[model samples]
Target: MLPLQIGSFTPKAPVVLAPMAGVTNRAFRAMCRSYGDELVYVNEMVMSHAVVYRNDKTLTMMQFGDDESPRSLQIYGSDPDMLGRAVHQVCDEGRVDHVDLNFGCPAAKVTRKGGGAAVPAKPKLLQQIVRRAVQAAEPYGVPVTAKFRMGLWDDLRTDITTGRICADEGIGWIALHARTVEQHYSGEARWEAIGALKEAVTDIPVLGNGDIWEASDAVAMMAQTDCDGVVIGRGCLGRPWLFGDLITVLNGGEAPAPRRLGEVAEAMRRHARLLTDHYAGFGGEEHAMRDFRKHCAWYLSGYPVGPDVRRTLAQVSSLAQLDDVLGAFDPDAEIVEGGERIKRGHTNGPIKVALPEGYLDDPDELAIPDDADVMALSGG
Candidate 1:
């Protein structure tokens, strides 16, 4: 029982799928959940502003497979009223089992507007956002959780403080991505910060994120920090089956054996099918085929393939092309041991944090500009 409980919801495996910007859609989540019976899959973070207005694209992005029980969605916004309205809107639609606030995002488009990780820098503003969201979801029994990074920058980290604040605001659970905006996804994650947060906050579950590239790493993190649960972000990319392995480990078994190329290739095909089926009207196979090109690098990573195969897969624009790409591989080949250690996703960081003037000078400033909401078509 790691991050085992949250109110009445007790995830059997307690392995959470962290929400990515453009990833983790309905199609992707269903595939991941299908791999593990108890996996908790979070939809990609959606800007509350978009949800409040009932943006078709945002609403579509929030879709979950019928079987995706305990469906989780991450909401990003800075306004209390708008955020509250957004929370209720999602719950009223009866589509969400959980709502996780996005205070951890370090994207420049988000931070520059005093949202995301920048919101935590202003405790009062963060409190407003969380309080309103929790209140809005209370009537619907939608458990509200929160996921965030360490802080805006290294010199100004605020993980422990934010943990206390979120716990105080009644967030059912909290996840900390043990790195700061400055570090982004570049430097090695500092698990020590996760331990510090676990020590500082005792009222609610403290789930640790970042640096968990393998199942054994999750075990080591739990042993090292005593955190309640492990929230996986990049580790599951192109390998939704990672959740299956996580389930085995949480159940006192070992992670699964190295995957055969055939198994991986088949999963890729299934993922493409799921995407096409779910996005039926949104370009159908044509859209799915193009969208899935991005996942090719992740799915077939480290496998032996020539430039021609790679190039062909790089711009896969149709199902026939996708089939050809998969056909070029030796499906029976095995993943070299520990190949998962290779890093992927948002690796650039330690860069200057974009922020409003004096955003860090006052923690009491609760007035986020009407413009601070992520309000983007993609990602926070």
Candidate 2:
């Protein structure tokens, strides 16, 4: 397998933990990193305004443990100036090793504001934002990367153009989730698009994302697309050990043994504890556990756990109650197969996509909006 590099750090394997909002926090990243070797874990997307203004919640999200080396931070914003300033802050602070620009989010709130996928449609804007962010990050010896979708929609295919622009702008790496904003994680991801993108950009590594539900799938993605690596998003939700599985498969080793209910509960508890500790200085354990309740369904997805038990766990008001509910699970129950790959979060059908007037008329328009023209959201 090919090794992955950003700046001075090189991971033996080319597997990355995709940054998921409300997930991929320090707690989750720590859990995943513990099971694998040489995997890059990214922080969830932080809005540029929030970061610059020091929004408590956003700043809290940026927290990384002392041992968390090669820290990867993903920042989202449509305004080039704000994004550039944000990159400078992250690099100037001297806390991060890599910075990833987010252009793949399909949230309507982001798209309605002419950000995220919408920015790519206007190649000039995309170029400006990337250029500014790269310039800001370069001085600190921090590598700048970008993650993007194939295009804003089926009618407007811009992945090739956007990928080329990012390459020309000196991006260290590019990750393509082979689905358009319109596709929105609906149909199967087009691996062919990844192959085409790899062919489009030669200097930097091209990572293929989406539909990598298992370790074998990662192997297949590489073999089929000849992409350099894979970025896993939903596949590792309930199964953080997936990193271990990916490492094993990449090395021609067997997948980790199946985990039982007791083991899964233990992992859930561990995740909660880490989150508590990570946020303890700010939110305390009660708030942290409250935030962690959302992950309960994901953790116990395919298990034979009853609805009542699941409901109770979901409604858990405190960590002690959560512990009690988790401890109530049958430790000896066999793990049900296929739960590992089920989709979680943002699975709803496509809504009407928003775009600027006559956006498709000119793909080359890269107008950088002034503060007055800035929209509230940039990506969806």
lDDT of 1 by residue, 1-380 (tens): 23545446678776788988888999988888888866678899888888888877787788888766788899888788889999999899887889999887676776787877788888888888899999999999888988888887777878877888888988888888888887878888888988999888987888889878888889889889988889988888878888888888977997877788998989998999989887786678988888888788888776766778878888889877788778777878977766787776667777788898787677797767454345553432
RMSD of each: 1.7, 2.2
Candidate 2: minimum summed lDDT over ten consecutive residues — where?
371-380
Candidate 2, residue 77: lDDT: 81
TM-score of each model, in listed order? 0.96, 0.94
Where model 1 places Cα greater than 4 Å from the true spot, the runs are 1-3, 371-380
Q: After superposition, how far is residue 327 of candidate 2 from its true place, in Å?
A: 1.6
142-179: candidate 2 lDDT, tens digit per residue: 98889999987777788888889998998988999998
Model 2 Cα displacement at 61 (Å)? 0.7
TM-score of decoy 1: 0.96
Highest lDDT: give the candidate number: 2
Which candidate tops TM-score?
1
